[model samples]
Target: MKHALNNPYITRNFNPNNWMSDIPIIDSLSLAELVLPGAHNAGVDKKASYTALGISHWAACQNNSFYYQLTHGARALDLRLEYAVGGDGVGTFWFQHNGFRSSRSLESLIMSVIRFLDENPDEFIILDFHQLNPGNQRFDYKEFNRLLLTHLGNRLIPSTHVFLTLGQLKQASHARRVMVAAENHTELDSTYFCEYIEHEWSGIGTASVSELNVHITKVMKFPPGGSLPWSLSATSYNVAEGPVNIREHLDRWFDPALSDWVLNSNIINADFFETSNLVRHCRTANLIKANNH
Candidate 1:
């Protein structure tokens, strides 16, 4: 019951979906203290139809679905929303990457997050809405607000509650477990959602594994300080690179860094998260930190 069939990518015999809930010690850690695995471009996945679009190789960062990412232990999701015209002549939000809108709607992905949270109540998640691009000059903030309030309701932790430990947040919400971080917002109130938490990236824009490794080393030596939580984007972008090629390089860098590099950041965001043992390492880190405390 704790595992799925053996897979070459995902680690076997672990409860990723309920990881936070399963580890009681994790509840004592604040969002700023715990190390978590995050999915970069969390909603972009490869399907046969998307592959036919010819951009799948470059566009897709994930080989699995959004729900699969959550189930596999991605606690933070980097989501970009695009307002696109649907077949019915109405505009709706879709998960987007590099100007390519996905076939999946943003609402569907949110619902899947809700479903996962409901099933595993103690597990918490951070939804980082980093960008909201509109197709036209005017975008409907009202509709977007309605979508969030209608679907997420009270499950969203208020922006003011960012400082709370997971146990404190759970008690504050009577057990609600999600924080919606929308950086650009007009109508949505801060009481229900927060701005995008700060994050740091290589700034090299496109980097090879060696370059990224150097960047991380420099940052950790002089990491920024603040009460707010931040993430380290452990990713490199290259249009010529596909998931497999990028992962092959990342695997070489990640395994060694898990024990040391992970200790420096609250969250470690990556592309193709399932292909590594990040979940296990993160859990181990949390346990050690808690025990030491």
Candidate 2:
């Protein structure tokens, strides 16, 4: 006798109800709403240029996006990669680890992250890998992460996409579905690959850009979609607050190549962080820190 089996939770075709707490943009925004490319604003309109101004990504290592924008001309991509290489970065990938009980497998971590992402879809997620000590047992999680990334090209809605800043992913490659990578300048590796974009980031919230430190990064956006994101969750806040020493911690994003290019990029847009309500971003970043390891 045999029985049929399905994935425990009954995977669907990524129904919004499965993960999205907010209404889908298809329901919220009309096709006409996000249109771009007026007659006057011209650089070089290639066919691949994303004409629609849709989808926004937020992260620490933002300068990566700045570089990408210079090379690639796409309108729909909005990248916010934050380079927070300020952790012990010990073991193997503390720069992206979740500190997961100090003794968990990558599978467990992936499951935890998946569940977390599913449960809280509104919040911008940072799957912090600054604490992982990958070994024989935990290598599965790393592989699973790549698998999930590959699937996202097919899975993500026009509204839902993952934002990432990789302190270390050895050889990452993904499907062409990836729209933007707001990461630092690096050789396109097998492990970490995305259509990089350029964004002007003040490099704030890092160890060097804290209140205690003179350096400051400004918010180009706030509270994620103008409301306190429900999915950004408690754990997300924990990670934002975990770093004790800001300056020493900033050393992680301290790539000489990245810093040099950032100093010479044309990604300066002051409008994103110029609102009175911008304090919400700090609140949110701190909250994310508080919730993570």
When summed lDDT is taken over every stretch of 10 residues in candidate 2, the lowest stretch is: 35-44
Q: How many clashes would you count in candidate 2?
A: 56
Residue-wise C-alpha lDDT for candidate 2, range 179-213, written one tens digit per residue: 22323323323243332322223333333233322
TM-score of each: 0.88, 0.26
lDDT, residue 101, candidate 2: 19
Error of 1 at 165 (Å): 0.8
Global Cα RMSD, each model: 5.4, 20.6
lDDT of 1 by residue, 1-293 (tens): 01222323234356888887777876778887888888888877785134136887777777778788899899998888877665677888777777766666777787888888878878888888877888542556778778988888778887788788888998888656787887656687778777677778888767767778788888888776565668787887774765433555444443423335655667777888878777776776676556555
Q: Pick by TM-score: which candidate is best? A: 1
**Which sections of candidate 1 miss by over 4 Å?**
1-13, 48-52, 243-259
